[model samples]
Target: MGSEVHECHLVCGPPAAGKTRYARVLADRLGACLLDSDQVTERLVRAGLLLAGRDPDDRDSVAYKEAYREPVYETLFELAREHLPRGPVIIVGPFTREGGEPDGLAGLEGKVGQNVIAHFVWCDPDERKRRIEMRGETRDLPKLADWDGYLTSCREDRPCWPHRFVDTT
Candidate 1:
């Protein structure tokens, strides 16, 4: 993988599934450019939420999903395209929609104009919940408060698309 160049890697999973940590190590090993959606979009997204009279840490709201998620992903892919010519690029995000099927993964390849490799990270549900609570990020307050509802929404199953499974548990 280290020798591979001009390719894009999508590292995805539910929150607290260790996507960013895995991507960082993988990027170092592959000598790839690393892009994290949170790092790229958090400040602006928080500001937007505040301006919209929503909680700045409200990442799970429909308002955030509808208004901010798409643009954040687009920016990540756009940045990936810019960095790809230099070497490999690794993008880390939840990517719930994009990791669900073959077409979605193909669409991502088209965006970067390069072969795209997808990695879906997961863990035992209990472990995930524990990690979420332990991290204590304000953004996770809603999820922690509604553990059962949040668990119902999280996908522990491997994606329908061809990809690697990273078990952080």
Candidate 2:
């Protein structure tokens, strides 16, 4: 906080984990640029579908993932790199650290060194489910429908590498 002209703040967790909400507040408090991977993915998916001439109401479809997952994450990384040199950047996403998927911040870490801080948002299962239902976001219908599977994917209390935990509930 003393001499950091710029830094990286990552707010990460599974769906409905209050990542975007908490990250918004944190970004404002820290004067950091807030970037949400989901929002970026949404825009990418929409444009991809439009360009491909494939219309689908479901945002969770495999088609979207196939078309945009890596690209979206890479784009977010690009955006982060651009902002990091100027000021703090807060990226919100499920940037899982220990999973089979590659860490989204891997490139950034190699670039920025110790200036990056990651915060994982955790919510009680019931509270998360209630929040999911309340929001009723179309992108989450699959997760809500397969709640048990969603829980299975998040069995790790320490899901990823070294990071602070923020219990949103």
Model 2: per-residue lDDT, tens digit, 1-169? Answer: 3454587877777778799999889988989888898776676676678889775334455686577666776777788877776788887777554322346345447644535687878888888989989997766777788888777866436444667889988
Worst 10 residues of 1 by lDDT: 1-10
lDDT of 1 at 152: 85
Model 1: lDDT equals 0.87
Q: Which ten contiguous residues of candidate 2 have the minimum total lDDT? A: 96-105
TM-scores, in order shown? 0.93, 0.79
- Mind sharing the TM-score for model 2? 0.79
TM-score of predicted model 1? 0.93
Top of the candidates by TM-score:
1
Per-residue lDDT of model 1, residues 1-169, tens digit only: 3444586899989999889889999999999999999999999998988898999988887888899989999999899988887888999998887766658888888887777899998888788889988988899999989999988877666767889999999
Off by over 4 Å in 1: 1-5
